[model samples]
Target: MPMNLLHRMLCRSALWERTSATRIVPWALTGLDLGAAALEIGPGYGANVRTLASRTGALTGLEIDPGLAARLRDRHGADMTAVEGDGAAMPLPDSAFDAVVCFTMLHHVPSAAVQDAVFAEALRVLRPGGVFAGSDGLDSRGFRLLHVGDTCVPVPPDTAAERLTRAGFTDVDIETGTTSFRFRARRPAA
Candidate 1:
């Protein structure tokens, strides 16, 4: 099976963990208000969707896999809107979301160009001063291989902050302590 096909299948499994409340709660406490309308890239199993929806007024999930998108739709219904699309080329307009969240989907995206495009899209859709945070399995001493279908990518942290900085995000902060690295960035207020 192709890697994309495997991701599609995994998106349906409820076992996949979502956002880390322990990590997110502190960020929220620091005055990053997520007002309403958040956009989540690759919300596998609707974990982040549940977390975002609980805090924000509305949430939208963009997923490349139809199976996962459909499962999310069936599970979330009207509370969270799930759309089938690529993160690198989102259909929404600029500054469309109060915040943008991408979690555990970077390694699966092949090529640096695609990563740039996705980061650009995330920055484009976010409101000024809006928060953008995500976690990716990066290069660590105990790095493990995550088999997403037929493709296996390095589950180690890459240059996510540099990518975000190039995309015009400011105040970029990255934390890489555990097996995964979490990135928290802010869009400069205009």
Candidate 2:
């Protein structure tokens, strides 16, 4: 997932980190227990990982960008695992995680089919009864401007539930906010 220079800079900025830590992640995770092991599909500059690592006992970040993934591994190696991989086709084992999350990054996946593949992969990697939750910005003029020269495919909140259900998720939930949408779904325990 390639990002424009401005987008890349913003992701690595202090403001982005602060907002992600204080607002976005907290809002998405309300009432949800991430459990012992959690996997983040696209940690980007790891702004969310800082918060996620504190909540879960063991955390893993699977990033598509090799450089970002390497940096994450170098910086958070002691506290978390960082793997360079695609969300649509994870290099992880089935039922290996207690939770899987992605935030503000799915739009970079290039297409709806890939996004659905990511959804399915998230379900596959979760332990039965595991959770998948995250947030992404809605399509807007501002959002579009921020993604110029990038692969931007915003996932409409309206259609997310159906996509999740089709991916074999249960209890699918999507909540649209002022500028973004948050979602959560569960893998049935039975």
Candidate 3:
């Protein structure tokens, strides 16, 4: 389901901006070049698209919410492609992207199995040696209250990397903070 107005506002709020997760997650993904074809799984409100666009030669995003996807396309359509699509079952061609990114949205996946499928899908869409990077919020009372009415599952510390490894990602590195976890994992070269 699409986020309501309140949820949308909060996702794009200063409160969300100030979080350490927002500041540090990108760092964990450093060194693996974002390359020409980059994809972000859930770019809410198009805030990071500008920064990412500067780094990537071409950028595309898959967003679950049709309304938000339309808004993103309208706002950044010249440089980025924003489409309404499912993360776990993206329609993109295999090995099409050089990098895949997500942010603060893994918890929204309904189940661990589904989340793993999403990870596998990221691997499927990535070209050889491409990087998959992201951060998801840790389970917390405050964050939960803020995201009330959504099915949120904070990945336990140290488990995300293991799951990514199981999903065929190597060189998996996961970093944990008080409120969230970020990771960078790569598909092996051909």
Number of the predicted model whose TM-score against the real structure is largest: 2
lDDT of 2 by residue, 73-189 (tens): 888888779999999999999999999998999899999999999999999999999999999999999999999999999999999999999999999999999999999999989
Quote the positional error of residue 189 for candidate 2 in Å.
Answer: 0.9
Q: lDDT: which is higher, 2 or 3?
A: 2
Off by over 4 Å in 1: 1-15, 18-31, 140-144, 148-158
Candidate order by decreasing TM-score: 2, 3, 1
Q: Positional deviation of 86 in candidate 2, in angstroms?
A: 0.6
lDDT of 3 by residue, 1-190 (tens): 4444667787787666544244744564556689999999988777677677877899999998888899988988987999789999998999999999988788888889989999999999999999999777788788878777767776775788888999999998887877777788999889
- Name the 10 consecutive residues with the lowest summed lDDT in model 2: 71-80
Candidate 3 ranges beyond 4 A from true positions? 1-5, 14-25
Expressed as tens digits, the lDDT of each residue in 1-190 for candidate 1 is 1355555555445545333444543343245557788888887667666666777898899988788789889988777899999998998888988888876677677667787888889989999988887777665334333353443344334466677899999998877755567777888998
* Angstrom error at residue 120, model 1: 0.4
The C-alpha stretches of model 2 lying farther than 4 A from their native spots are none
Residue 102, candidate 3: alpha-carbon lDDT = 87
Q: Per-residue error at 117 for model 3, in Å?
A: 0.9
All candidates: CA RMSD (Å):
3.4, 0.6, 2.2
Between prediction 1 and prediction 2, which has the larger lDDT? 2
